[model samples]
Target chain A: MALPSVSRRLRHPFPFAILAIALSLSTGVASAKLRVVASTPDVADMARQIGGDRVSVVTIANPRQDPHKVPVRPSFATRLHRADALVVQGLGLEHAFIPALIEGARNGNILPGAPGYIDASLYVKPLQVPSSQNRSQGELHPLGNPHFNLDPVQGKRMARAIAEGLERVDPSGADDYREGLERFTTLLDEKIEEWARLAEPLRGVKVVSYHNDLIYLANRYGLLQVGTIEIKPGIQPTPGHLENLLRLMKRENVKIIIREISYDPGVARSLAERTGARVVPLAVMAGGLGPEGYVDSIQANLEALVGAVAESGSP
Target chain B: MSFRFHVGRESRRGGAALALILAAGSPLPVGAADSDATTLHEQLEATQREAERTRDEVAELKRHVADLEAAARSADATPTTTARIAPVNADNPAVSFVVDTALDVSTQSSWQSIGYPDGWNFTLKNGELFISAPIDPFLRGYASINGTSDEGFDVEEAAIITTSLPWGLTLKGGRFFADVGRLPHWHDEALPFVDRPPSIDRMIGGESGSEGLEASWLMPIDLFIEVTGGLYDAVGSENLETLNDNGFFGRRSFQELNFLGRIHGYVDLSDTFNAELGGSWTGIPRDEERSLWALDVTLRHQPGTQSSYQGLDLGAEWMWNSQRFTERDDGGAIMSRIRRRRQGGYAYVEAFFARRFSVGARFDYSESPEGAADRARTASAFVTWKPSEFQRVRFQFDNSWGDQQTNQRFTIQWTAFIGSHSHGFAQR
Candidate 1:
């Protein structure tokens, strides 16, 4: 079968011309909106708060999906290709997929350690930093737990980082970003106090979580974490571990269990039946419960915790 | 004064009196001598105490110096132990090894034709060692070596890809699996079934990879579309004798080199469902000029609200080949041309009902390569259990019918990976 030569194939100009024209038209009009690609929806929401209308935000991980297992799709690379800045939750939270996406995107400005790259975790104090880097500890992040966005205080810090990153990318819009950040922070401050007051009754409450993701929230509200359903970070609980956890919960009089919406609730429910604990499925990020903004999701999480503790009785 | 007088009386009183008499030339006053002797004795006592204190200070300083020396030695030893605990090799590339083993049981007396023996044969099919690293700011390199019981060892894929190419273009050079169809690009261990679909195996000769340079362009569009083209010396494995150095083609010309082209497009119907369509073409020149064309489609549905493992995947691939052979007379002159055309396809549907368990079925059909009147057909069902991301076990049952022969085979395959191997999306 004699196929046409490469020169003859190249001579056909109609499709090539159409493709070139389409690409030019699509990219020709340079909008002033800063193209911001965030690692997760919560970070995207924070970027939106800081950037307002001055930025266009694209989130890599869906709100309802597990952040640890975000799929690396070609669309992510496409979005990152045109981005002026990239915001990440960063202390290895996006380790599995973000690096590959950045590599695929081939955008030098948004690579790690570059000016347009922002690590939101940098502004906030990390939690659960292990003393030893041991594989037996399961999938532990070497830097620390990367889920500090659960704490509203850290959310404000993340907003500030996003603002700084936007300023670096689009210096002309720096004033707008700063003003937006101030307004968001003021609102966050009020919510934090209100959330603290609402959570006063549950202070020092003994609780068990399905994973170690709730440490920041627990620390914020003074909830004493007695145990976890999973044996380690990212490791499923063995029967022996579950048995020990059940005994510890019973002994400690733990009556509240917090679990992320992404995790299966069957184990939590089984433990609840055994120990009379109320299982509360909370959103790990901004979108787990629904399509919520950052502040709304944190508020929803606070409400879920308070209600579960109240129903389960005081510590 | 009285103590001095007492000392002089007890010890060398005679000598002291003699010296006093010689100096004074007369007996001096006892009170003056006693007072002078007392002052001298007190000065001597103070000097002895000072010397003793200085000796004690020197001993303490020596002990501290010894402690510091010991601490310095300990500090020197600490890193070696710490390194054993957490070894650091900044230049080492991310490495992973995957072992794929299978147990096969067949009703036929010998399955050796396909590299498996009948009646509960345990085969160490392949152990693949993969290494990948960023070579520099502009390029990244990756290599995979597969060691098998039969083939010993072979460089399955070794390629360097350009990272910072302009216009969303990526260039890859070296040996790699050509992106001809969905299944060919995937390693056998990453495949959904225990083995390659029968039709793909028959049509493309198992895995269609070659040593070549491939350039891919990601079209700057709202949707995902990638166009790729490459040129290779040969289209298949080392065993593809028809395309390799066999006397059938005599001296091959540069024009006879194999060429491959493919275009893949992806679209998301919704947050939960997405579909991909791809087409590929390969031209191979031999005594009989041959060209193969393939089309593949895949649909996946995984709700964002649900676990990733709980999803549905459906896929299909169609392949057609055209071969033209020029017949020669006794004088080595071409007499007539014979043309043969063959087509084959396979379709599969898989559903994951739980996080760890999945069930799938595939149907394969192909026209006989020998131009037999009857077509070859096979049906297979497989159940897979993935305990974690690192390990998977699958049990598959196959029944094939062709050439008026029916064969039944059962296989249990286990595949596990260790270390860092980021292949982006999970195996479909």
Candidate 2:
């Protein structure tokens, strides 16, 4: 993907300089490659899926890893330094470090005015914005929830956003990006039905999750909302709260606990043990995930969730 | 924006001990929240603020190193000046374009419309032009020209990182628009769910950004340690006063952005347990308001801490802050109400179970010497599910009781990331 042919256009007045090396050696000869960096494996995969060979990617966080905890190592800075553009999961999802990292890297290509930065939340529908906007309560994303990376329909739009950001950074690769998007969507459309079929049994099934994070997925698969493992959205349940939740789960007759692999299974596992329910491991993103890309990663989770449910015998 | 710690004494304690268990993983960021918000945001903000400073400190150290190196070696001794490479072929028909430009138009039609959240017609919400080209391995930049209700056409960030120096040093100068909390950059905006960590309101509701000069260096420690520090116009008096109230600092009394510095360090042990320790101090603005200086340490255990606990990320963040809030003549913090000191310490245990699932419950106590428990000790939890890669749906609910008071909030969020397919990997 390092099409170093971009050097043909410039006659550097300075023989030895940093910018010269950047232009003559690294950037492409005919077209500067879309140097894209995605926050998570899933997002990275999606970019690659639609970006094809026209863009060079340096994925930051892995799929299997907890993105919230991913460190901003020197390598990450190096990745940011070289990037012509960055494609990130918007919605404040990577709210932890990506913003600061981008600022520190100080690459002019991505400042607000540049086309080197892509925020994927613009096109997605916002779900749980606070009914009231008041600091008296706590910090809130006035724009809405910052998590928009898990919905398939939104996923398609995200791809389009990435493609647009890429085009701005590397306009010559427009055709390639277009073709990549077409192929990516073609595969995505096919995969959706297959995923639905695999998860057919889960449709209309009452289920409980360790966290309410997977609402998009559950809704997509037609999983009914039962309850939660935590007492609040961020605060974990104390023993007393857990005891009460256990009582509620038993009363509600919740049969399965759908938890993501990145979460602490201790509570969910305990609940499953107490209620004779099954705990299923769900994959979150693409990188750190089983497959090579976003679609494959989701498919993997779909299959895994279905497999966990089918074996649990929840009809 | 996710929070981790709650406020009050009768909150969930010893959760750090649970960190060793398979259930201790939390998906929320450190101390980016407050009692009024979900516990996740408080913990995230507290956790990240200090670490971010340390990184800055390291950067400042590296800048010193580079400057020292230059001084040690005379300009004449240098064989040849560094190269100034021109950009790649600007007219390559097949590849010259290396940026994406798009106009994002969004309109909201709300029901209930509390506070008239409805009727706010969506305009051309944002216009972005992103470029990751230049092909320089040691340089990068990011920016966004936005038209949100706050400030129109604001430059989010416009800086550069040049790693062509020794000891991994880099230079950065321009506008700064980075938020403090968990979740990287604005990616939180693309979270699978709709509701953002409450910290967003606190961070952005005020003035937009701090402009200045920043320098950094990647340390050569046993592990990965980075130092960064800057001399910027501190947070203005308009919202966050990052200067002293003495009214006699740096031509202050009317200056924006203050003099602040920070340093950060991190280590990854065995791919499962990771530790990041950092500290930072900022000069408050010139006003009657107090200043802030904070220090924090964060540790995370992964893989179950590596186990069906799938990917368990358990983090315990402890922060000690010397943050001084201002009280107006009427003893109010804001113009309309009372103001007081919000100093002291905060700590929390954060956990993220799955990629799409995260929850943080924390106990934070802040007293103004004569104020009530001021800190709201509450329990909060969030369920996030990403049906696909581009969209996230989140259900956020909290059971918070602070100062003998109880308040509960339930929110659902759906976030979508859309790409402008019309523009591909093409740029000028």
Candidate 3:
């Protein structure tokens, strides 16, 4: 019995101990840099700004694709599986896909309500919070609109939150994250002032948009939104709705029409021709127009707004 | 307590002395000593009354203090009940319903020719209701019930999946589709075509699933590698009759259970192209020991800088089955053991040239399971129009050739989903 017991003990000697040692060594290397998964390209850019050289980032939604219709791919799950932290726009913007990916990834550190999870919307006040949770409101976000990333001031707050999230997961790099956040904030503040000055002529300018995605951008530049080309949030425009929108546009004397690049430009073009308003196609997210980063993308949008207003004459 | 009593005693003595002085100073007194004595007696009585009053007030204060102590105890108990009760989660699980119906027009005149009594006719192909929710912090549950025009209803899938297992390990229990092949794992509504490929349907059965427990691990590497293993009571309803005849050959021991294993790999070649390859094996023991092996490859191309709808999907799958049967003949003598091996597979290519329109073609080939029948071959083409993410309509045509039989069929399918759902019908 003693010999058999000795043989059995030898057969499984130190298996768990070996596993523990291997895990510790692997985690030691992995803990040196944070891995972040962002729900959209803009959030990915913000995380990059905050994490700098201490982080690696992957984005789920591509810039050219509509964020509302992002496909749920196994690749997204794989990326999330290795993520140490997660940053999302919240307000139900990524409701369709992000939950499934998180569940599939099976990463507890990034689950909702965890310390490594960052809901960027918590940092900035939301707009268009619906008074009623009714389907008749037409695809309304129950919490609020989740397009605050387009505003540089709100983007700064979102970057700060992401930095805090990174620091929570990788505390040794807390000082590095804080420095990165400060540098990003200063650069963004200066840019915001410059963009505001360039957008001065667009103040009080009446405009129509293809969808409600431009609300944050319009608010930042002091544009008065008149109407939308769509009858509802995701619904196609009916003839009656189009006629009513045309009448309202004429009455309001809308000077410009802003359309996202992801949407079909045919409707925006026809409306502009009918109303004599200049049509401006804007890249709603970073990397949509080109490989531009966050700040440059926002500047490009402002430049487009200024050029559109100049073409439309004085408001 | 003693301090209040001392003040009460002092006040009573002072009142008695003052009353004595007041009576002595009265003008109507007959005898100064007798008046003073009466006045002292009345003052003493009044002092006794004041002491009784003060005692009663003290008792009342003690009763109030007891009541307050009782109230504080009751307040302490209130939160225990309230805290034990928690508010329900407002973010309820997403529920979705999908209805897939088709109008079929086939050259075959009778349902028998199509294998099913209800086939070869316009029918409700499938109506599925799906419910999924996170059970807790560590697990999520999903259940789907399907109804068909021919078969009334069945629980298609009811599974609980671990969401927080370490090392990228996921454990799933309850009934689910067997991870045998690419097509079998996909729900009918999630299929790219109107009907399953002829080879898969003829050889391994279409949409075969079983009650099982599965554990899958995603390897910790740069490339996506998943290894999965499962144990099931039976492979599926299609093979249940063939495997178990309710005799000695029926499932009686653990050895009769089905065992399945699969290894899948995914690689991203470029921003626009990715490849997925998988190999699967399953074994079941009974009077006839049946084993199946399948290999699948899928290549997808979608430019990151373009719309998601514009893409190309090319896939191919090959499956082989072997069965050995031992049985006695009608003459009460042992018959020669029968051994059969059949092979089947399909290859398909689909392209989305426009945002909403997609076209695809498939070629299917299979060896007949029956000894007398010849090989079967089929060619199919389909076009799908998706107006939105939740709705799709497809038109398909199939041409088939087999021993002494030629068949042609046309199908128009309409599928729609309603309510909140994470996985759409055509995500695969």
Candidate 4:
């Protein structure tokens, strides 16, 4: 009988409603740490670098998992549901599952146009944006290649975008985020210069990557990208394509073949053996280079490339 | 510092003496003066030419800025009115078409074939067109139209779902598959097997599509849990027909409707392994009520590497129903009152041992709703090859034996899709 009476009072406007609202507000303010969810591991690293102690970051896709086809797990949606902001590598990198996760999360704060939705690609001038799309050309990112995270120089821009998103959601931590971004960019500048020096021997060196993933890296290091092993973007290399690539590699005198660690190494190794080129396995995302995150990952990539070039006895 | 200044002064004095000697030498030649005048004139002409170029460049810059400002003004003025008026195709939804075809051969012609034709028959089974779009900030709309060569066409699902409901609540209204069990929710072409399990076909009376309203709540907790409740005008048509023919589980008045409730939970056992469990119930309330309850579970393991070629799946579902039956005599007098309970289930395991190939087998057992003594069991095995994400071909063999005549079937099915086609993340 008392429960019925209480419910009846709730049905109408009463002082309890105001009290409940006040209690909720107090609880929300008491434990205010911004929750950020990133679509990929590298973006998560950038978020952590910029968010610092003011925010907690969770990544939906594992570092070693293929970004193009991340398994839509239940925990990903749950994490997104509680996130104050959602950071994405963008440029259609997470196209397969991000939309579904966002819809499943049912969080209005992180919708596409909402303040908490941070698209890191907005700060990047993307490469290889298709002029027109056709399925015959294979899986295409209409906006551009979504692998800008592999470019160390673009890491600074991604961090700035993440910092701005954090400041938008948590104005109280704006100064902290700004300081974190400054520190990250300054360190990145020094590392970029160091890597450039280390990459001096790779200048104008001919190389072939398994996919279009290494285009930005080649652009940064002055490596001449002769051709890719795959016939099309997502398609596996056909036998005919491989034969053609072998001829092209030999003709171009390609010294190194860069293959992402996540992909199967058999094809890359086969081509390397046939063409007499060295195969260098590299991870496209963070966490594969140990615990130091983005800086260490880029440094390791540079070292691997330089080492491969040296082994090939190339200038 | 003073010594450096003395050196600088001495150097300057020497330069002055050199200049004085040059000036005195210059007085010895009118040709030198003429040459100096000529050099000064050349310098003057160069400065004039440079000024002219600067003037032209400034004019070009002004023109460019004016054009930019004009374009900005035009853009600013045009958008307020045009932006408010949406484009003709602004609301155009994502549309996709899928077609499924099959060749089915059965040993016994009298056996029930569900939706497929019996005996040696090749069929243009069906083609489906799906359309979906966000209706507004708060609503999403989805519709699917299915057409078969023999059945013409029908609307399978058309629903408006709430997107911005508060407190983890989503409301869906219109015709849609009732959230009763896993198999009923999937389209035929998307099913793991060539067709639905025999248990689902017998227990749920085929696809449980209905005109209803459903509300689902994603519980705010650490784990993934969703609770859903639905009210429908009626259950499956076959269910109504079967129960109504048997005078068991049909409603007498328009006020009577079917109600359903389901709870689903998912957990990640590891980075590469996950499991999902769901329980569902649907019933019509009356003095002698009719109700069906189902429990389903699925476990999946997908390695992070070579995910396409390395994966395992195991799934099973069991359903039980309780109902009251009324028997009548030829003289229109009640003969007896009967109560019946029946149960059935199916289990299957599939593994991807190669990049584009998978093989699986299923065992199905179900007691007929027609009578207590009527029952059937089936064993089926299938091999599937998917050339790409959009295309699949499967060959299946089924053998059934029970109260009905024993039969065997061989079926080959091909399914293909075009355009943007996806059933969302929860499809798997």
Candidate 5:
């Protein structure tokens, strides 16, 4: 009888230890709202619109910095440690820093394959999938382009994914999350249609960008992408490469040079001065334009493109 | 059963079969044999025409079915959903290899003796293989093996780190770099300079690594403060000279074990500026009375938009050492035992004006730790360029002047890396 009692006591700690671990990994359980962490400002904005009052959201990467090279700050890990759900842009966009932060967070709830880990890129069709790649070929995204957020139509899919992600982390608020998602989708749909009509002038306008961050936006409208200022995707432009680009621009009559606000405008400005083209400083992510929401960011970029194209086409 | 396809062919076939059966089975009346035969012949001809039309319709139906099946197959081949981007291979330990080679020219005749190569020498400075992985839910593991042309491969570090402890506690066990100061904790390739500063080289022994167990606590306060304590069987590099009889404090008993304590604090001064300050104490508890104390500070500035392109770094560290040394009389008699107090330090500034380039200058001053009258002062400057994330090239020049010796040296180093190597949060 004594042996049996001792064995029972020994068995109790194992279950208790597991319970403790479970409690540590689960976040915002004792609070009224769920905690969500997004990899970029665009995803954060979308999560806010979809989660509404039922959830609180935090962004990891700064919108003013290049998305590819966001520094992994220690405070970001602390935020992730207390988050209930993590929504990532995925498609290798946050490859450099997000993985390190997640591992440092030590929060098993948001690890890959877990219910609280949400990859919004899963809902959108990927573009520019390389047939072959190597470092020598420049910074090519092996999983295709990850800038789907720039496409206004892809916003609907990203919102839906975030809503479902919130519901998964906080099932008690499933009804609220679904209603919030519906409201966001309705407004975004109307805005997308209106923006498309306004972008008619950019349909046939030849355009170039500082980097390849504009493919999704170009495809959304009918803009003809003729060239890029950079020699390769992430490679800086050399003089020889610039010479070729200028010739191509002149021959193609490219009227607009689109540059992300995060990049230095030196090269793009030089190119524009030589080719008699207008330079358009566009925001690549939400909040890149100072607290602009996701819809407003896209509209701002679209208007910049349209205004430049119209100005150049005037007799 | 009913089908969506036309049944015209089947209907014609049924009529023809019925007419043929009637013609074959029925006997003609004697009187109307000719007329009946003519009627039967006409009906037979019509039945044959209907059967032909039915055959044609069936052929067309077969072709349509083939086309529909083909269309479905093609549709099936097109992927409806984009494949998830494969996450970086996190399930397996990240394995990486690095090779460092250098061309050296110096005033010293023997490169190996001075820790710098002689005139116009090519050397394979170091080769390293690094691996890291999450061992389980509770611990993550990391290892680094290094080799040189002169010395064969050695296990530089192999440690297990705690992952999911209840509090803000981290525990590390096995061989690792002692957190005595900022310089001692950094790997050679990660250092901003070509070589360790002379002050650190003389005081802490070139590479101050040890086999030990360390535990750190992240203080529960707004300021980023972490305190670490470690216990080691011995400390210092085996190849270095000086300090506790050839740059190492070996423990013969449990009481003689080496111990270290460090407190590090970091603060974000502004959106583009941050600073870190740390204090460290390390000593061996034995009759020899060996101890070292150091304080370090670092400040960095990087604008949000041009973080990768431009930055400024200012770092400095000061150290104090006190050790017991026995003096010998000229008559080969023990004169006395005295504890010597010596001080040494280094300061450096680096500026990154472009995305791929940075230049830095450092000054070092240190007194002999052996209670001798010799002291050294050195000045050094270096430029580094990174062609890509996986490769680096650097050129460094140093001028040293001391009571015992004066020397000048120049070195060019190139390093290449492959595979998924990462240094965790400390890389930035």
Candidate 6:
């Protein structure tokens, strides 16, 4: 065509190179693609599956980390900058800074009023919402228990909700997102039922746990969550709390104490010795010393439950 | 959160705590050796009986405290309405509503009493029609009119903060107060352990109003260091330039640089004292036409728990600024001429005893080094009560014994945080 245009086109021959770079970045840049910040490992896994390679996912707390007491990090702000969406459990189960962190970030879509925000609890049927958390009694979850991720069915549904939200903001790859969500939910539903059956022997068995975070899983298998080892969410039992717990277990003849790998086993062990109750530590979220994916997580927990029940014969 | 009582057991024991140890240790017979463990069990059973009685009292006390706090929070917003109890049965869903309103009436008698007692005082306080629900997210708007004895019809502060953010951050906008430290904060909300520390107030000259926007950044630091900052407006008054106050074509106000910075580093020194050092500063144009600097430090200590005296928090600061002048009643005269040295600094020490009850005092002295202006000194005392986390009241008195003459002030303040309210009824 024109002399200047021909020379400019000849000088800039990197169009193909630029497209390839964008394609590479599309997968490598975790913050820009559907950036997902999950609160726990299971949610992170779910987010990964639902969004697939199109998303950049980061979980704030580890699999075995106590979700209630998880601390926030400085880089979380930087993560927020790249995050296009935030998927979190919102039933009042997470640590304090959850609200503070969201309030202090760069991502505009994740703000409370924006469409890019998704609180997984909204899609699930939250349980144990308390009237109030007045310090006089015990801890409470004013918006229903926030630990719904433990329930496989609810977890799958939440994944679907998350996927839908991701698709709405980003319509370009909607089919891939829906397919990914479908595969995850289908696998989850099958595994959940199998786990329930495997845990059949432990159904209705009296149990004591480190934290009351396991009510959903317990209810599913009829494992009665008798009492918690801790009097408060983060506080270790005072001499008074331990002493009172001992008397209650003695009177009830409760023989099993549930434990999580994250907490100190010393107190629970001593309490077990004093009361003759078998101590059984249970996992609260998926990927908690279990398998990686949703179904694997359920299977791992089922096996653990069977072993816990067999190890500690029911009264 | 799970508590059950056998009908017969509640009657036998003083309370439902008789099975304290037995309840928590109702173990599944997982192992073998513990079956014949009757001796330890019996001993635990006996001690736990005693503990059960004590547990009942503690539980009731805690429950009572919780109920009282809930009632107090409810009362703040629903002043006159009687608190309705939950329905007799759980079948009926529960609903209770509350509305809170604030009335502030101020009086200022100006020296230039031109025609008639030339001072301005009226209902310039914040009036908010608050509607709240325990189970929902909310929206709030405020009407604020500030009538300074001099600057009439000034819009002080107003805005609504919401709970929806994509990355777990709360978002707020709409003519809100800029996050300028001790100076532009709610005056009555200041900690009265002593007079407002000069380094945070007088030394750091500031104004009110936020126009552009702000996004509070909560940097993800490690477990020890907590860091947060805000991107906000540097100038106050929507009026960028008054000399040409055309609402549409008005001269743009000084372009606000990134707002001030807040960095706090807290280190636990030892068993007795916990030391916290904080530094705060903002970028703003000065009256002398130069950008100024405001920095403060806090050093506090509290004897370990065993000591008869509970604890203490003592700290001080230094803020000096000097400049050349331009013109902006909004106090935005940039210090581009930093040579004039329009600077001043203040040193203050404030300590609180027992956390609950104590005294705080500070002495502030400032002047424009060349004597082209005036210098001042002030002493003060204040009492504070934090009945609960969301409720606090304070009483203060300030004596300016210097160039500004001796004047004292009395104030009472209250705050209620109705975090997120959902409005299903309105949208329907």
Top TM-score prediction, candidate number:
4
For model 6, residues A1-315, the per-residue Cα lDDT tens digits are: 233432342343233334334543554423447767776677677778988988888876656656664533434544554567777777776635455465444455675657767767667887776666754334566777776776777787788778887787678879988999998888877777777678788777777777777777777778777777777654346688788888888776777887775666777899999988776655666676656755676667767767867876775
Whole-model lDDT, model 3: 0.77
lDDT of 2 by residue, B1-428 (tens): 11222211112322322232323243435443223244544554554555465557658777998998887786657646587567686632221111212122122332111111333233222334333333265555544433444335544445554634544566766655321222212322432222222222222222224566767665432233455556665443223233333464435443233444445555566555666555554444434332344455666665432242333343232223333444456654464433444443334454555544565543333333334434444345556664433345556554444443444555555544443111110000
| lDDT string, candidate 3, A124-184, tens digits | 8889888886444566788888778788888888888888888888899999999999999
Better of 2 and 3 by TM-score: 3
User: Cα RMSDs of all predictions?
Assistant: 13.4, 30.9, 15.8, 8.1, 11.4, 19.4
Task: Report how far off residue B71 is in candidate 3 (Å).
Answer: 25
Q: Candidate 4: lDDT of B110?
A: 58
User: Which candidate comes out best when scored by DockQ?
Assistant: 4
What is candidate 6's lDDT per residue for B1-428, written digit by digit as tens? 22334323434552333354355466656453264245446656665665676568668867998999999999786868476677775433222211221222223332111111212223222222223222234333443444433355444545555444433344446555555433334332234432334433333433334544544433232112222234444344432223226665333344323344444433446534444344444443322233344444445454422121234545554555544444345676543433445444444454444323455555656553343255555555655554432334455454443444344433333433233322221110
lDDT of 4 at B226: 74
State the lDDT at A117 in candidate 2.
78
Candidate 3's clash total is 0
TM-score of 4: 0.83
lDDT (Cα, tens digit) per residue for candidate 5, span B1-428 = 23324365556556766666577557867767777767667777777776677678678878999999998998788867678566776477778988888887888664232255567878777788999887987888999898887778888879998877755678889887777778777777778887778788777776677788998865443345566788886566552222235444442665456677777766678777878777777766554456787888888886657444688889999889887777779997878888998888899999987767899999988877654366777899999998767788999999877765577899899998776567675445
lDDT of 1 at A214: 76
The DockQ values of the predictions, listed in order, are 0.18, 0.02, 0.11, 0.25, 0.16, 0.03
Q: Candidate 4, after superposition: displacement of residue A39 in Å?
A: 0.9
Q: Ten residues in a row with the worst lDDT in model 6 chain B?
A: B110-119
TM-score of chain A of each: 0.92, 0.83, 0.88, 0.88, 0.88, 0.84
Comparison by lDDT, 4 against 6, better one: 4
Q: Name model 1 segments beyond 4 Å from true.
A: A1-30, A130-136, A238-240, B1-88, B111-117, B238-251, B285-287, B325-337, B372-374, B425-428
lDDT scores for all predictions?
A: 0.79, 0.53, 0.77, 0.79, 0.77, 0.53
Instruction: Work out the TM-score per prediction.
Output: 0.82, 0.45, 0.78, 0.83, 0.79, 0.50
Q: Which sections of candidate 5 miss by over 4 Å?
A: A1-33, B1-92, B107-114, B239-251, B325-338
